[model samples]
Target: MDIRPLRCRDFRILMTSGVVTMFGSFITIVAVPYQIMRLTDSYLAVGAIGVVELVPMVLGGLWGGALADAMDRRRVIVLCEIGMAVLAAGLLVNALLPDPAFWPLYICAGGIAALDGLQRPSLNALIPRLMKRDEMAAANAIQGMRWQIGSIAGPALGGLLVTQVGIAAAYAVDLATFVVSFVLLAWLRPAPAPPGAERPSIKGIVVGVRYAFSRQELMGTYVVDIAAMFFAMPMALFPFVADDLRSPSSLGLFYAATSVGALAISLTSGWVRHVHRHGTAVLIAAGVWGAAVVGFGLASDVATALVFLVVAGAADMVSGLFRQTMWNQTIPDELRGRLAGIELLSFSIGPTLGQMRAGGMAAAIGLRGSIVSGGLLCVGACGALARVLPRFTAYDERTSPHGRAETTEPVQPADPGQL
Candidate 1:
């Protein structure tokens, strides 16, 4: 198959924005929980932050997705970035306050999450407009690579900055990244609204919801992803592992190992492009992820746990590649933003619910037992999805409906007047 990348100028701007945003986002992810821990010295308080963040993210994704479809996508992204920048500045101010209240931290985190909800779908919808039909896979691969690279660097850098410089310094770095991202986004021309787009309204939001749920393949992907995240999220247990199973230093080591594994797979972008049965690859990777989670739960030594985490990250990277490709390719340009919103909603809900469940189960049954049970259930869920969506297992990129390799011609640029 002949695959090329998006050559459009706006796509380059958006991709550059993604790199900066991901790095800053990762830094915040590391710094936030650590800051909460230091302030309250309570695990429940940290978990509460997750809950607060999830609510706004899910709500914003639905509304944002609808708005993206009805308005100019580039403008929507810029507005979202600006909101994020303001929130980051607020965090910096709060840090400097004489008595930084816990409630303020929670509010800032929720605000950031809401802004991200708006940002994610707009960006996902913009990719196809930038590329030829045949280049969707490669474009998605580049996105996956960018995410993994940011994930690899962000936490380590955040940790170093917080440990050496201070927590406030980490937030300042994040604030700076948002500034750079906003500047890049400002340079890009706006993406034209889809043909015949209507004025934005609540009815438009309902329409997007209706369109997204109507597609079988898209719905199937959502089902599988929700199932995977609900049963497999191990984030709630990280602190326990650091405190009980290993030293605090080992926590960073474990995260670094996982990032390295993901980075290794992402760097081999060429290899991912060649995979034919992408859906099957996703299923197989999910199974590996389950097994690795189980292995980590049972591991007695820090070395063994780190090894299992590396395996889990590798499996995660593979699964992410296929899942992203499936979503980006199957959705139509007109509905991509809303569908991406629905996708984000489903994605966020699962982990949010999972963390609550994990925390509760760990309290009742013990951390190891909770981890083991979740992993086992995840593996079983994958098998169940395979049986139900048997055709999904047979999906091949070469035979895509958008255009098979033999039938699809390169996209001629839209008329200069239209652009």
Candidate 2:
């Protein structure tokens, strides 16, 4: 991966903070569900965690986008980090209680989800300010690697801590990570609102939404990603897939396979900076993800199935890298936060809906049938989207008007204000 972005002091600080927080955040990711399952023993109650968090996250993303545009981006991130730390404390305290209440899990989970939604648009929007535009692909790859590392390590450690030491220990570790992240994030330079940026309002949010839809290439990214995830995301079916393949003990591998693949790509992502046709890259990656899922479905052995899943994961990582690059390279600073909000939804909502789609389809068809059918549908959707949105596929970063604008007119920090 390109290391030029790391040369910037602010970028280094932000990346470090991200690395610490992601590890803590992911530990909580495992703890929340585990605690809920232990307390209620109801799959429905555990599943309802997603439902409970969804609305708040959606509202938070929209409002947070507006907030990021209206305030100092660094301040927004710092405040959210503090809020998250408080939530982590809440979880820690509750876990320490002799008789932990069932309801607190849902409350903390929802609150954290909202805060995460709020913090992310600011975080995503802040990246361009931290480094040169040409280094974005490398930066994105590095960030992706950070996430995969956290996803893989945090959960494993979380499981071990929760099971061996107790749930309170897991929450404590998460809380500590937040405190460390807060201090690091506090050191970053101010990223003030764009000049003449309007105060966050429903009207402003609507305008952002309108702008996102008005751009055909932007729409292509959103629609293609949604379709790919909605049709091909099979996490909900992983346990069943393992059973079907007669490797129930290897179920964890199914979950880890994609991350491993994504990590491998991130490790070797130097070539990504050479690619100019980001749109084409995303389209190809999504199609490959679909194809890999189909191959996974058809595979009769665990090793074969895992190979396909890894390919799918790597493809998804490629798609994500370019989608992020496109948004960063094309979007105006004034609208970056709000667009990042929309970008969050395009990626977040898809997987939620996808699991639902997977479960419903698996019941309607058999396991392999659901996986196979969904993969086919994903590919078909990509083909249809490509035909309709030719401009997106033809988009070349070196020559596109938006990319040219980004290159010619670099972003400048607005006058600093009190955080």
Candidate 3:
């Protein structure tokens, strides 16, 4: 719904590249899991993929953050995309073999995850540079819509391609998307290193971590996000959920349904500009996500379950918009990338652990019990986060010293209609 950011040439160009890459990423998302099921036919085996890549992802993110601060971010993004495309090609070649081995899939998956970890902080830190400071929240809302569109279309189409032509076709399409993205990226004007950036090193990463820790407001964003994701995410169990519904073909729908909810919310996100208390919005949205997941766990019908997933997805989009706005308006340019890297870890680690938790608990308590209990725990964790991290809850864009530091405009109360 927020369309102003597109007026900037650089933002539009950057978004064009993002749109293409996201489509490719979602294709890989479905292809990898579906391929594992075809090969070994075990939920635990599919879940183990996350575990294998966790360390690589953590390292890539931390190191990538430092690189973004100390080098040309545009170059880093292109290099990472090249790595991703090469890995996709690996998958394609293996799918062509007369007897494709399972291990190649693991290798490709792990490689791609690591590259993605390296790429995200650079991409995230680059966006604010492309647009005005006043447009931050709206820009994030628009970015969320781009991801939602890819999320909705990619899996549905990826599933069809995999089921019809084969995994080779899906991989081929994914590889092609990366090609278009690479070409687009090659033309972007460079975003050079910030002035006086320290060399990329573990010690540099530690300094970033320390800076993030000292600011309780920033920590609030990280803590609440980690808590919600670690406790409530059930995406790793979707195949089994589809199987329980006696509709294996609906597996892709299970993934896209959440996007449907998120897209609906993004279409009307202009109201977010009026919100002065971003931290409060984040917690409220996350609590809604927990509640919706609880509904999904209890759903007896496929339609009901999909609806609940949609609500959960909407809540997540809202939370992400506020969280990103918090980062852009408060953190100075020199520190943005390293902090974004920490932000990347907060988001990425929680989902990885959550998937592992979901898969293990599903094996023990049954899928429904695992999901329901996890949702309840997510709600409790968020409540605890709000109480303990008062700084996050009290973070108002209007008066906070941090928000005022880098803002182009002084915070002011606006008429509900004018913001």
Task: Indicate which candidate wins on lDDT.
Answer: 2
Backbone clash pairs for candidate 2 read: none
Model 2 residue 294 CA deviation (Å) reads 0.7
The segments of candidate 2 whose C-alpha lies over 4 angstroms from its true place after superposition are: 404-418
Candidate 1 clashes between residue pairs 3 or more apart in a chain or in different chains? none
Total colliding residue pairs, candidate 2 = 0
After superposition on all C-alphas, the RMSD of every candidate to the true structure, in Å, is 3.9, 2.3, 6.2
Pick the TM-score winner: 2
TM-score of each: 0.89, 0.96, 0.91
lDDT of each: 0.78, 0.89, 0.85
Better of 1 and 3 by TM-score: 3
Off by over 4 Å in 3: 39-45, 240-250, 363-366, 404-419
Q: How many clashes does each candidate structure show, in the order listed?
A: 0, 0, 0
Report the candidate with higher lDDT, 1 versus 2.
Answer: 2
Model 2 residue 183 CA deviation in Å:
0.5
* Per-residue alpha-carbon lDDT of candidate 1 for residues 5-51, written as tens digits (9 for 90 to 100): 63667677777888998999899888888888888999789878878
| Model 3, span 6-52: residue lDDT tens | 99776787789888989987888888888888989997888778776
Better TM-score candidate (2, 3): 2
